[model samples]
Target: MSRSPSFSRPPPKQFNTRRPQPVAEVLKRTDAFAALRAGVEQIAALEKDLRQLLPDYLGSGVEPGFIKDGVLALFAAHNALAARLRHLEPRLLSDLQQRGWAVNALRIRVRPQAVKEPPPVKQARMTPVGADALHALSESLAPSPLQAALARMAARHLRNREPKK
Candidate 1:
């Protein structure tokens, strides 16, 4: 004998009773990760200060790196940006010193940035008015390949507008 299909509701899902811990808290609980996190935060703070000191146009292409023995490293996205950074090194060093950063010198490094392609442009959709116009034009034209092509285009667009059952 054939059996009938059952449509009863499934059992309830069981979730954990304990509350989730925040990422920062978890990182702080670990030894190695805590040190790494501290270093990353320090760099972020330095970058913020550097951004404030730099001109608006130059700030975006340059980033602050680690400071070693009173020398601060600056990474640039391109060679031209690196050259510009080098030209402004003395001013940047003096500004950083005035800000109590303990920076005595600036070293600029060229790090090529990855090129990103822009998003593809969307194709314009065919409106019912345009499709109707094409249909009328196709009707007015003589029986030729061009007329057939126009009729096909109009039909395709009009058919797309029809509601499906």
Candidate 2:
């Protein structure tokens, strides 16, 4: 009974029986996409080299953004990591230069990981019984700020529950 009725029917004419080409093969066929893929590969290679030159902690926290006009852009996970990277800029620049990289300056930017906030809490409504209980409790208490607050809360709850004309 759970089987789809369409299972007995033939597929529509729009369906293609041929297998699709691999993504890399498809991208390589387009000139623009091929260039973009090449740039991405170059950046990845640069990042790997930079990572090898850095300490474990710094390497893990940093990612190479891009290199343009002799300026290499780097993204750090936090301000502390960025600060550390900035301090090591001179040494890194020299090292990269010595390794035949045409880098002249390092541009470090903070790029923190996005944090997901918890869903908002749903407010609990006071039942008539609960409001009545609060009213009774307020009545029993002597004149005080707490008693007044409880009385106001009870009245508000009961008033809100009343139907309008």
Candidate 3:
């Protein structure tokens, strides 16, 4: 006699009735959060103004920094760019004022842009002359760890150019 396998009933499905809350309502509900959001918005507006003033020059290296005690800060990717920004402080102040911003002092700070290091390049066969020079230099040196290592490396490079038997 053969027996058949039976399957069990699946669990019941659940439905969520709650809807997402609106951002405006949430901001309105919290005073500190609302103020923080407003400050962020102001910084964004300042960044927009900067882009309008100097388009394509900033790229992703420059950004609007926070304003504290009426001092506005701008971040630049490199010192050169920071210097340029400093030079434009007067213009920046005037432009900010025109755009309805209460400007007191403009500060430019250098913040190096983060970049991924490039992949290491594979070792290529050294030229005969270069290999010969390295070999000679290695031989001229007194026998020691560095000399041995250099000689070994030079031999490897020279051997790399030779056809394997």
Clashes of each: 0, 0, 0
Ordered by TM-score, highest first, the candidates read 1, 2, 3
Distance from true position, residue 91, model 3, in Å?
Answer: 1.4
Using alpha carbons, what is the TM-score of model 3?
0.52
Q: How far is 150's C-alpha from truth in model 3 (Å)?
A: 38
Q: Top model by TM-score, which number?
A: 1
Instruction: For candidate 2, write residues 85-144 as lDDT tens digits.
Output: 999999998988888888889999999977769999967689999999999999999999
Which candidate number has the best lDDT?
2
Predict model 2's lDDT versus the native.
Answer: 0.86
Compose the digit string of candidate 1's lDDT tens values, residues 1-165. Answer: 436446544533442336686656656756979777887787888899888988888898998888889888899999998988888888888888888887888889988889989989976579999999999999999999999999999999899888998
Clashing pairs in 1: none
Residue 75, model 3: lDDT of 87
TM-score-wise, the better of 2 and 3 is: 2
Candidate 3 lDDT over residue span 1-165, tens digit each: 336444544433432236566555556656779777787678778888888886477645688888888888888999988887878789878888788877788888888878879989986778889999999999999999989998998999898889889
